[model samples]
Target: MTDQTPRLEAYQSKRSRTAVWLALGVAVITAGLVGGLLLIPRADRAEPIAVPTAFASPSAAETPAARATEAATRKVTLPAKLLSQPRLTDATLQKLADSMTLQFKDTAPETEDAVSGFYGNLAKQKLTMVIAIDAPVGNPASWASGMTHGLKTSLNAGPFHDVNPGPLGGSAKCADAKASGITIAVCLWADQETYGVLGFYYRTSASVTSDFVKARAAVELPTP
Candidate 1:
């Protein structure tokens, strides 16, 4: 039993030191594993970003080509009486139509049918002429310009300006010109299938846009 207490104390101290070192080794290994996990790329765990989409514009229904195609399918004819005037006899109308045919022969070679008439008394007379023609006009603006040019050169008319195209939706123009010593309002309208000319004797272009619109509605028979 000699010196047994020192030996027991020394052995207990050694065991305590070994336990402390084991705890430190476990903490270091855990820290290294956590650092390695943090170093991995974040893209694999993050949600994907969303992309945006675009839409297209709508198509128009009242384009010029559409209108022309619709107009080509309809019939064009003038009524027996227009602008509240008595219906002229067929012979008289035919004679006027013949004269128009001759007048427009070179100017409008596409003319297929013609109708002509006079309304009101001599003091306030008006003349209306319409021609149904074969026009394959794709652009209404250019066709209107060319028609105005023909009027200027063939009829010796002045510069023409645009007017209200009316509910029918084509092209209309008017000009003031001297014809037979009278200041006349000359109006012209052209659509896909018809060409019309109106002369308001002793009147100004400023005063006859409404009359031209009315006469156009009367003479051009559009299908429902």
Candidate 2:
């Protein structure tokens, strides 16, 4: 028989071509799938970001409720037993109140509470003051955190201690703060019921804090 090797070779060559075409088709399909994946929208897969905006700030004006609250806070005075003998003079008290009011003008509106307290002479023309706040009946620490939020200068926190009239959770103190450049010292305390602040003043921040520590016993703290 005439050799059929040539026929067989031709058939094998045809099979190779068919195999090549099948492989190419698979590659093309895979490439199309990759291209489709690349074209898919990605925006939906990304997380949305949050942005905060403030429309209007609170007014500096003290509302009638705020004013009444301040009055009540002041009246929640330290008991005579706690008050130092030779109690604060009406004039000195007024001056302290006026000084605190000035501080309040710069700060009161920042807080969600009312302000009250009185001051007396620590020395000639120097003042040691106590200012009480009528804060909500919870979280002294939250109230303390914002003590100097909008103040002219930053406050440095000092040691935390218990108050004499000992508000429920006691009190924490911060000093070396300024309001419109005047030196001030502050303590935040709770009477186990409400929270209040004590402030001391001097010509400079250093002196005011030192005096604040010394005068803590003199100031009348609030009761629950």
Per lDDT, the best of the predicted structures is 1
TM-score for each predicted model, relative to the true structure: 0.57, 0.39
State the lDDT of candidate 2 residue by residue for 100-207, as single tens digits. 445543443222333344444333334344554443333334434333331212333343333333223344545444333344555544432244455554444344
Most accurate candidate by TM-score: 1
Give the poorly placed runs of model 2, Cα more than 4 Å off: 1-75, 78-115, 122-125, 152-168, 179-182, 190-192, 203-224
Pairs in steric clash, model 1: none
Residue 79 alpha-carbon offset, candidate 2, angstroms: 5.4
- 78-171 in candidate 1: lDDT tens per residue? 6766677654333444455555445444344333445555454332344443443433344445555655664454343578999997987777
Q: Which residue segments of model 1 deviate by more than 4 Å?
A: 1-71, 87-94, 102-107, 123-134, 154-156
lDDT of each: 0.54, 0.39
